[model samples]
Target: MAGEVRAQGAVKSGQLDFPRPLTTVDVVIFSILDDKLQVLLVQRPAGEGEPFPLSLALPGGFVDIARDRDLAACAARKLKEKTGVTSPYLEQLGSWGSASRDPRGWSATHAYFALILADASTLTSDARWLPIRDGKLREKLAFDHGEILASAIQRLRNKVEYTSLPAYLMPAEFTLPDLQRVYEIVLDRPLEKSAFRTRILSADMIEPVAKMRRGPNRPAQLYRLKKNSEPVYFVRTFNPPE
Candidate 1:
């Protein structure tokens, strides 16, 4: 019977009989911490015959076909397992696949990037935040994760110039200055204050909350991302200050 072809490597009408490559989902989780753009990385366990043991890599694992409904579901499951926080700003970055990329076998990984408030999550013991310096990592990552991470960072910085993506890095309530600082941290340059404020407020991505953040000078109005808000794209990229 056609439905009886359930054996491993079984040949069906148009299905290939060869073994499948290793399939997995990887997430590049980003957050702002210590006034710097940081990424969450997990250390691989040390074991005999294990690939890249004791090396730091992005949080990911093999796709559980029984559990995950799709690529995005697998990404979210991996992210939540590692960070204990489900971010509202998860995006599909890209997919990387090659025989030489993984030592165990030919593997393909669907990579997703997420932005969350640093203080909103509790990381497992093996996971830690590492600062991204000058759009790169100082230490090498296991597998092709270094390349994946670089791509994620570049995508993030590029989008930040024209989209309200940085708002995902903010806490629940914050002042306009705080929001601007987060943008500057991700973009690695100072944005014009007046222009930044004008753009952010006009975009209608955020709404004024009832609270205020009291500072040394005076109380500043607090704002939160509007309910069910999506990142707002600007007409032009934000140019650096003159």
Candidate 2:
């Protein structure tokens, strides 16, 4: 009799449950390429009844409950599937959902942003990097992705002011000048060299490698991010060079 009561309770709850929303995970992958901060976008497959046929969109897909253990897993899986690259820095941005966001049905999406080296992986033809000029995109994106991308750019720029985020966009080994160039590209301003060097060194996020990068003028010391190093948060934001 107790088993029957439990089954009846389950049925009652099931009947009361509202319709589930369409769930998906999307990732914004950023890299430095061509002296600009670029984002990877994939072309949506053209298909009959496709919502955004032949349009570019952020890499993402519906969550696979059987395969994805959680949102982050789903995000990493989608990132690899779309870009053929895995990022060293990935963070949850925010969630977006609405009845009007998707034409198929009520939909909700979990968004994540990631930083990667441009040369880390070869991108498939469907995926390509587009330059983000002035923290904005020129082309329209599919499925409300334009708004999502804008939010990601804002988040990344805001975090870069005080965090060691630009480090993830660097190659395995680089010089201090190389690292500073990346910071300027992302922040869209030049930082005081002495001040920037002091701040970065004091953070203890990177260590000098034995090797050096030979350049035209002279050899510069190469440094790599410390193993298992997390982003170092500075107490103050970077100020533009006077």
Candidate 3:
């Protein structure tokens, strides 16, 4: 079938009547820091008329059909090669291709989105996390990456309201307040502490660990995602009072 052929990135005769589109992958890596949502970007080598030449762009690269197992493997490899960081969670955003999107030839790209904790020490050289607010990212990231990033950000906001996707952005152990801050930042609104806690508990999204974080004021209990807790859409969005 065509689908199977595409999956294996092959053709029986190793030839085709028509030219196939070149396949590449792009990744949008996101993190939360200081209550601001951030994205990782890399500086591209100098080039002529390139939107991001000698400037920041998303970490990405072409797929190696001869070696890569699949599109995801290509994305993972590229992310490590360009950023020296691995994501705790990575999901396919979708496919995109514009006739003028790439200059090399007719090209199509499969976009991926990932969530990771903010820690510059974990990143490779020349990679940096930048804040996203009021269309600031669009001006910096190049080659339709701004559009790709906007879609990724919107997906996160929509998913966090009904699903447990936010767990990917959290540490192995976190307190209610810590989780709440992540939610607040992603949702771009403040949530009532009591309501947020009650909803999370009722959903059974996380389980308490015996350990507690020792802090300045009080000891906060640690919690982690419940085993086998798969993401599910809620009947209504979670909008706690401010």
Tens digit per residue, CA lDDT, model 2, 43-115:
9989988899989999898999999999999999887876667656889999999978888777899999999
Residue 155 lDDT (model 2): 92
lDDT of each: 0.90, 0.88, 0.78
Instruction: State each model's C-alpha RMSD to the native.
Output: 4.1, 5.6, 5.3
Please report the candidate that would top lDDT against the real structure.
Answer: 1
TM-score of each: 0.93, 0.91, 0.84
For residues 1-65, write the lDDT of model 3, one tens digit per residue.
44543554445565743456777899998888767888888888786765557767788877888
- Output candidate 2 Cα RMSD: 5.6
**Best of the candidates, TM-score:** 1
Give the Å error, residue 22, model 1. 0.6
Worst 10 residues of 1 by lDDT: 1-10
Residue pairs with backbone atoms closer than 3 Å in model 2 (clashes): none
